[model samples]
Target: MKKIFICFALCLLAAFFKPASAQFSTNENIKDQPKWGLAGQKYVEYYYLPDIDTYYYVPGKQFIYQSGGYWTFSSRLSKANRSYDLRGGNKVVINEPGAYRYFAEHKSKYGSSSSNVAVQKSQTDKNIKRQDSEKTSG
Candidate 1:
């Protein structure tokens, strides 16, 4: 009976910690994102390329660009935009799945701001803060 009770307690403990472990992993994923993606974002559905006026669907790994007045989705950029470097362009992470549908209205909205640089600065600040806290605590 004591062994069964101990086993039950261990099972309860594992169940309680499972969700916390998953949450921690999700946070790590967000912190390790690429430059083309938002610095601290997970599950980015799309990346809006303001310079070339194109959208990169993250989940599908496809590029959404306007071709001949119609939206064309492809795994690679069209021949015309092949020269446009993906890394050099400013990208906005859109978490919504159908974010491209409203691109026409919001395209100019993000164009006016230099948010890419701002996000990088914010991420740096977070790292500094975390280091300072750890130093003081430890």
Candidate 2:
């Protein structure tokens, strides 16, 4: 009876799993990386500002398979956030694209010395606007 139960549990687990072939793919050698974003959680799909480099904690999901250059797994995708790991780190299991960089200057400028992740500011970044306003109005 115990053996039968174990077999049944194993079969259930197998049934729940989605084969990697039908799911996602990995571009481990992807030449480009994804752009970076603010501290907010989400994939920053914008023009990458190369001047200021940053290493954003890429959000990821509980992916288990691969299909067509994307990770595939039988899990509901997180809407607002790109999926995050259990420990709340980058969920992008694969660094297919840069997606993020380390902004040393921004860190120093903002007086943020967190060694965990870096962030960049665009030439037209909001902070730049604020500075411009301060310059003109002041």
Candidate 3:
């Protein structure tokens, strides 16, 4: 009886985890690199910078922008964007390989969704928590 119950439990657990395992397998081609994603996520193909209207392609480690009526892909931002600060800006992850090609059509859709507020709010929350903790510890 105990062995039968164990077998049933195992089957139930496998059933519950099967979908999750399969889902991860489908994304095996996507890489999980620290330098590629926002919020410290492991895998992301592109980063849409709404503030500056630019796209950062994570896979190639390049930034894509419009120049002379054509899309330019370069490792560094163009002269006009040299002053743009990446550390403080918000980033939206694009997982598709062809994400850059579709930039012209989807830039506005993703750009409008600002991640700055979330980043700022998180920073503020962290500061408040640190202050509270310091007050109690000291």
Candidate 4:
């Protein structure tokens, strides 16, 4: 009876404890990011394009936009945004997960006007430029 009770307790403890590998699940996306996109020390999860009210996921490399009143994910932007230049366009870095969930707040804060939007250079872009300058100077 004592041996059976000990075995049962051990099994219960094993069931309650998760594997060490599972603790790092949140960073699983980091492994799949493009080399250039991972240049900086900071990890960027998404980019909010206020100009068109779209969100770009860096890890999955997918564009999140509104279509038919629902959030749509696609690798390419719609035809209407084909002319938009991502490099030069205004971008707001959103490190939060599921950034689209706060669409109303983002829209209100960063309206259609460029002047109202607080544009920021992505960390990856900044680091790349820094490395390029260093190579030329060194």
| Candidate achieving the largest lDDT | 4
Among these predicted structures, which one has the highest TM-score?
Answer: 1
Give candidate 1 regions above 4 Å deviation.
Answer: 1-35, 115-138
lDDT of 3 by residue, 7-76 (tens): 9999998887844344344433245433423453445566777667777776677888889978888888
Q: Per-residue lDDT of 30-125 in model 4, one digit per residue for the tens? A: 565544332342456776777888888888899899999888999988768978766656565566678889889878865563532323334443
lDDT of 2 at 112: 37
Q: What are the root-mean-square deviations of the candidates from the true structure over C-alphas?
A: 10.4, 18.1, 12.2, 8.7
- What TM-score against the true fold does each predicted structure earn? 0.57, 0.18, 0.55, 0.55
Q: Is candidate 1 or candidate 2 better by TM-score?
A: 1
**Number of the candidate with higher lDDT, 1 or 3:** 1
Let me know the TM-score candidate 2 reaches against the reference structure: 0.18
Worst 10 residues of 2 by lDDT: 129-138
Sort every candidate by lDDT, greatest first.
Answer: 4, 1, 3, 2
**C-alpha lDDT of residue 77 in model 2:** 29
The TM-score that candidate 4 achieves is: 0.55
Ranking of candidates on TM-score, top first: 1, 4, 3, 2
Model 1 lDDT per residue over 16-120, tens place: 784434434442344334445644454456777777788877667788988999899998888888987666556766555476797875486666544442211
